[model samples]
Target chain A: MDIKNMQEAELKAAIKKVMQDNFGLSDIADDADFIKDLKIDSITRMELLLKLEDEFGVRVEDNDAQNMLSVDATAQLLKKIAG
Target chain B: MASKIVVTGLGWSTPFGCDLDQAFDALFNGKTATFRTQNINLDGLYCQVSAQIPRNEAIFPFEKWQKELPGNKASMFTIFGLEAAERALLDAKLIDQEGGYVDQNLKIGVVVGSGIGGLEDHFNTSQVILEKGANRVSAFYVPAALINLLPGHIAIRHKIKGPNQSQVAACSTGAIAIADGARMIVEGRCDIMVVGAGEASIGRLGIAGFCALRALASGYNDNPQQASRPFDKKRSGFVMGEGAGILILESEESAKRRGAKIYCEYLGAGLSNDAYHMTSPCADGAGAIAAISDALYWSKKTPNQVQYINAHATSTGLGDAAEMSAIKFIFGDCIEKNSFAVSSIKGAIGHMLGAAGSVEAVATILSLHKQKLLPTINLEEPDEFAYHNDKLINLVPNNGIEASLDCVMSTSFGFGGHNVALVFGRY
Candidate 1:
């Protein structure tokens, strides 16, 4: 449950699980753009961010949340916040 | 006569299944769809019986829709509405095999409604607001809770670029939507209309709310099938039902131009308000009488001309009695002489709330087409009021009957005293 102690691979897996649960996208690539590749609109993007905040037990600011457009970026942001 | 509005196709996602003929067959054979609720948790609720769509059988194409829209985030009613609309379009031969419109030039509109729009979604969103916070609410909450979104999503999927509207007249919503769709075509606003209603509010909150109103059937939780007994002496209350019914209405000229098979001519529609009670019909059944009279007047048919009546008898004692009184007032000697048959499919499929009227309209049109009067199942012993002047009015109790039919009427009475009567005749 603690994202702070989780490995990079584990964090990515967790993020992919969330994406799969929300959007039914099981083959989400780590570097795929949320909007362009996955077609997650702004509203769905906000919902996904909220889910991530809940899952990782952290807060995401508006500007940083907007910039977390890919699974890799989301993982990096979560790591920085966890630290 | 004015340019006719004709029904070209019909579709329904009902408790019996999506196949119209199969569902109507089940109704004709006196089968009941009511059963104890499994999907909805009803631990302390007074009414525990409901008639829900057979989800596995009536499947929606979620995968195809997910590619374009967030299908998983859409409300259940919206999904059911989409399925029904697709089936109707296919039945009407308006859509190609890939579910796209066959004719790109026709101006096709949509009008669908619901009694309580997305109550289940609203309940879930409220829980998020309570347990988590308002900021955690999903962005799809507002869109999912809106009634008009059902029609909006249908329009988006089919690329329909014409007049779109939603009716919200409680149980009369489906009938009103059909009437409004016909009006659109009559007024030259559109050539074809996909019109009906959908409802999927059979959740814990919906059941509890209706239970609080003392509007749902009870004491038959263990015998759910017999809970909806319209016109029977032991009839108590209605069983909650959920589904969608969609019909394709086209102008006669348009349908002829396309060589579409016409189901029946939409002779006329009558809409009125009781203005006496919000939930109860006027004591004299004046509202229902006026609506039926208006429809007959508009259709230019006398009471004796109607061969069958799909009565809005929702298995409730007061409602059934009031409708009988209205029918008697309108068709006095006709009832006494058994000139026409009357039946209520609610006894078989329960009251489908917003979808009830259109589904029943489908039954009515089919009765005219097939020349069959569907049975009011569970009517073992008809009530005393079902008889007039020592002659039993043909309630078509517990058995289907074949009759020569040319004209038929379907009646829908909703909460807020909304009453609608639609008359259909052979094309």
Candidate 2:
């Protein structure tokens, strides 16, 4: 699904589902840091970047991928990319 | 005082299916799970037949796990181990989503072994290093390839805090994991131990390595179903299988206090080394005999009391016959009287390598639980060479055998002449 056109709520839901299903995680907060809160390592971070790119139908630059560390940041980036 | 150990839960992922009843039924009915696979790059390889675990939506449901794991962050080995361990914990009634009765204060241990760990990740990482540079390699490559990390991941996933370790003894890894995990419980090191093995080495490197050793069954590539014929006159070699098996073991006192449904007692395990060849077993079967004898001795059970054996017959010409010689030497008249029933599940699922022992141990424990013996399919005519005493016992050939099983033995021998035998008794 092209997640680029998704609204803020839809984007957040999509991100939440990815975190839960991919990482065997639950109870994720919008402010939760992927590294600090989710305990996702660098490998998982790379995986998250690729998944978000595929979901939004937008290519994530390496620099921007590093900046998008939390759910809110990721959704914001997705909105900017979609626009 | 040492505590008594018992298996309260069992879980496994195999080619046939994960449901114990359905998987065991298929195995007993001579159903073959082997198939032709082009997944592994076998351009120059001789054997193309393998018992690869198909993406079963009902059992593993990777599509669900994939939403979160879109990239190659998680290895196939890790998935198998996690899935099996989760089911085992649920089966033991130790944990649920809301967190069941597993005490957070208690020290829980995990021993998930593997014969070959994360070969696909290793292969990809090496190519990256060669083309780009060492600095360009993925950070997860090292942790994913290390065998010990299997248990590390499990312990972290389950929040298990205690003696977390893994045993990598090639094919004997699964049996050794159970043996060592039980020892930890008996020695009062942990209240509960999650023990088993996982193998997902069906990659290009894995297939090439084994094929170079001439260790695979190549003739039946066109007929994948008949590729792994253990103890048969036409037996050649084992077909590579990928999966995992996990068993939840707890102290007898802990199990009783928690009112957990017990499966079988983890009597004891015997380990020995041939100190001979690296790949071939000794013709005399000296290591195997000692391992079985030591298992019986440690379990304090006589030869007459054990009525069934989950043989390590890996469908090899020498390996099959050597194991039978050892059995006959130990169980003697039991074989003649048909009192001892022997079977190998390798014929159905092929050789799972590291997961073979633990998976077959599950099969053995299921036999004890259901009071039945599973069949060793594809054994049309027993190889005359496999018989040492000139006596043939009920091999449970090609069909399931319904019999009362009180105690059972499961054996696993690896490439390094590593021999491990485990005995389980009715709880």
Candidate 3:
């Protein structure tokens, strides 16, 4: 929950909201994995990344991209960058 | 001896999205890109909802969509094919704006197919003539939508000077292109082949034409989202889809020399015709069985080895059952009758017509990569008309199984009983 930590829960909530609003992914629970559990697939994940880049103001590299697979991971990264 | 054909790159444009990676990504995630469009601004015609590819005027120059002026739907396929080819080549490490991948000695080919072609555009042009006048009909109708030109334009633009061709087998158009391209590579005609299918037939004329033939789901119009339910009891005809799917096919030697990224292996292809009726398959599944048998034969593998099969189950009354019976006959009682990793993307994407087969091919590749398989979305109530053999355990929807599936085969049959199958195996 620390503002300095990038992988915070709030950033994850914001991303899940974006996915739900744009791509209609309502079934994605917090514990859901991006590729298997949340089922965001690869393309939408890219789309989601594009949205995140705009929202959180971060330029995620391909190496960093795959690591931000889960909402929690993305949140943690986002908070670290934004803070 | 036939040479080995490997897939180095694949590019697809769908109602889901225009980019190749984007479509492949979405297919794995189980997403539906369907939506309603009432484009009253452009002449006020009631445009029925469709999985429409948003025309990026920059990529698809409006002028290019037309030979002379005012583009039509047929040009949509041609335009999309060109863009996809570029992307595929880029993916294949062949040629890109970055200019690094093409091997000078590599003989390249292009195969783009369409199920319905520019029927809606051609049909709309006819309507415009009746409503307004003959002169109002742009002089560009014939040049735009003819099915043959889908590949012609792509070849002309990219200067793809090798075995230039196209396929048209109704919904199986796109898959046939891949199969055909694989054949070209195996036969040593080309080192690299660009293959995919495209369609832009979602206009009123296209849907109305299918409606006239009673081949579309009319009852589910109220709920468009649920309209394309495949393999369920409440199932009706397929929902018409329009778009293109392209793949970069190359020989393994050529790909390795160039250091290209390979997605998977195109093991083999099978193609056949029902020779029965225009649109209907042999009700007993004879034609489908023949096509599948040929595919397996070409693949040089027994049915038991293929862990998963992406079926051409369009959720049609006779087509789905025919395919099931065919699968039963080929796989025998033990496998076909059991609950396997059998499924269809049409249930989610509707009938993509020509684009159906190629995108589904992508799904199969992803299946091999991730080791997961999704069930047919609307397959809740199991109807065993053609699957009379107890060996067939119908896979239910919403539940995908994760397994170490190695070889997966995909089937696509078009109207006029044109049948094609592509076999894929793990690398």
Please identify model 2 stretches exceeding 4 Å from their true place. A1-43, A46-83, B67-70, B98-101, B131-133
| Residue B378 error, candidate 3, Å | 2.5
Q: Give every collision pair in model 1.
A: none
Q: After superposition, how far is residue B385 of candidate 3 from its true place, in Å?
A: 4.5
Q: Is candidate 2 or candidate 3 better by lDDT?
A: 2
TM-score for each candidate, following the candidate numbering: 0.96, 0.87, 0.74
Which window of ten consecutive residues has the lowest lDDT sum in model 3 chain B?
B40-49
Candidate 1, B51-159: lDDT as tens digits: 8776563434545556545534678888778878888998899987545754668978999998898999888889999999888888788888899999998887788
- lDDT (tens digit, per residue) of candidate 3 on B195-298: 88877777766666676777876566456666666667788777766666788888988878888887788888888889999989898888888888888898
For candidate 2, give the docking quality class from DockQ. incorrect
Tens digit of lDDT per residue, candidate 2, span B271-339?
Answer: 999999999999879999999999999999999999999999999887887788888889887876768
DockQ of 3: 0.01
DockQ measured for candidate 2: 0.19
Task: Place model 1 in a CAPRI quality band.
Answer: medium
Candidate topping TM-score: 1
